[model samples]
Target: MIDLHTHVVPPRTPFLERLAGSDPRWARLEPAGETGDVIVAGSNFRTVRRVAWDLVERRERLAADGVTGHLLSAMPELFAPWAPAGDALDYARAFNGWLAAEVTGHDGFFTGLGVVPVQDPVAAAALLGEIAGQGLLGVEIPSAPPGAPLHDPVWADFLGEAERLGLLLFVHAVGGALAATFPHPGAANGVVFPSSIGQAVGGLIAAGTLERFPRLRLLASHGGGSLLTSLPRLDFMRATTPALQELMPQPPAVYAQRLWFDPLLFDATLLMALVDVVGADRVVLGTDYPFMGADPVTHLDDPAVPAALAAAIRVTNPQRLLTSLTAPT
Candidate 1:
């Protein structure tokens, strides 16, 4: 299984200092040691856990879990709106450069998803261009709303540019004000609800962004925040609303086909249900690795998942999503 949702951080002190200074809330945030790294607080949310995992440790963890490769992403707090945009972009550039350096010679063992400063889409676009030649499989953005919604007109050009560049967009639902309503709200409870992110993705689809940029590959973390169950209602609403009907293509399934979902549901039934709804091709393996409630091995061991589906979720689907990083035929 190729775990597509692991996270990494740069060890540079200046970067950490910048992060600490960029957001005022960092002063009140506490740190916890996990996997030999620390995660600090950011903004009003406390559920965002940050850890700096070394490449060696990450590879070892993958090997132990029978995971072939682990795609590196940013922690949720890394893209907070409260952070300085320019500083965030610089940190992203430096971090992506470091990540690319660490992963390039490892073959399929390690691949990275570049982080972008979505708060500043233009800068984000520039950073995307800089990392285009790097062995980055995709780009990670925090889920919309608390940061930037996918349907926000402000991000249209950025999304369009990403589409033109043939890069996949991976949205990990992060810090938000609505996380308190979740079943198990934590210190960073504001960003814990995957359902809210799913609703945001649904809204983006309803707004015609997917239709507008058909070539753009999108991956929503945490089983697309319950996408399997949400699609039916989304389709029903679209059909009943003339404006939505005109904006979206026939049936919502078309949009589903264009998007990909990661396997982080933690339940065999939910994961399999996603497969039944979106098919095997759109489901990719993701273990919110090194984080609480995320286990790499268990996700791959579900009996309800067929071997082929599991393999696709673990490897093939991610390869398709991060097309640029795959070796040539």
Candidate 2:
């Protein structure tokens, strides 16, 4: 099995110490040891003991669970999107560079999704080009600004550049930093809602951004947050509205076919629903590993799921997404 959404941070203590001292916006991160473990405290989400597990250790752990490979993403807070663009870019470069160095030695055993300075698209694009050449799988960006809808035109250039580079784009939800008004407030407390991520994705699709860049592969964390439900509406609007029909090459469903969804939905019912909506080929496995509520392998072990579907979710889909990054001469 291949786990597509595990996380790692730079194991260098100096970098962690520097970030803790300089960035008051990060809710006080404290480096606890020399082996790249840090205690991140005072955040809206649950506090976590972030540690860097060596490839051998990680392999052994996964092997115990029958997982053969892992696709590493940087821990969410480490991206520090709230920081100034220049500082964010520096952090992004440092993190990506460190990830490349660590993973390059392991080959197929490990792969990574690079981080980018989302605050500045032009600079982010340049950094992405460099990382892409290094054979990184993709870049991670927030669904939107702290208090703004993701569909805001501000992020267009960043999305456009990603499309041009032929890189996979992963947009994961950040819990506390979501825009002020929750997209859907009626749901029960424990239930998973796809509001913010859905809004961001919907905004991009409605604005014709995906239409403009046909080759871009966008993956949304948390089963793409309400996007599956919203797709039918988007399709209806496209069919009934003549102007939108002209703007979009096909219906919204066609555009969705280009987008990818991760299987972070812990419930078997939801997972099967996502598979029906996005189809098996577009869904990848994401563990959000080491976080309290996320366990990717649990979904893999569910008896409700067919073996063939589980294998595709666990291994085949991730292989296709990462292998797409091979640089052409």
Distance from true location, Cα of 184 in model 1, Å: 6.9
Writing each residue's lDDT as its tens digit, candidate 2 over 1-329 gives 77677776554521555665775555333445433334444333333443344566666667897877787887766666677787777777777777888887865788888988776766776787887877787887777645345455666676677777887788877654233255652232124336767777777788787877788878888887778788788888888898887777677767777788887776788888878766889888887775645454576668988989988887898777767766462
Tell me the spans in candidate 1 whose CA falls farther than 4 Å from its real position: 13-52, 145-148, 180-192, 293-302, 323-329
**Candidate 1 per-residue C-alpha lDDT over 1-329 given as tens digits, one digit per residue, 9 for 90 to 100:** 66777776555422567565665543233335442233445344333334345567557766886777777877665565666777767777777887788887677687778877777877787777777778676798877633567787777887887887777788887646555456665544334556666876887787888888888878888888756677899889988898888888667877887788877776788887777777879888776766656353475577777888777777787776666445462
Which residue window of length 10 is worst by lDDT in model 2? 184-193
Report residue 57 deviation for candidate 1 (angstroms).
Answer: 2.6
Candidate 2: where is the Cα deviation over 4 Å? 13-20, 27-55, 146-152, 177-193, 293-304, 327-329
Instruction: Report, for every candidate in turn, its global Cα lDDT versus the true structure.
Output: 0.70, 0.70
- Residue 59 lDDT, candidate 1, scale 0-100: 71
**Candidate 2 residue-wise lDDT at 164:** 77
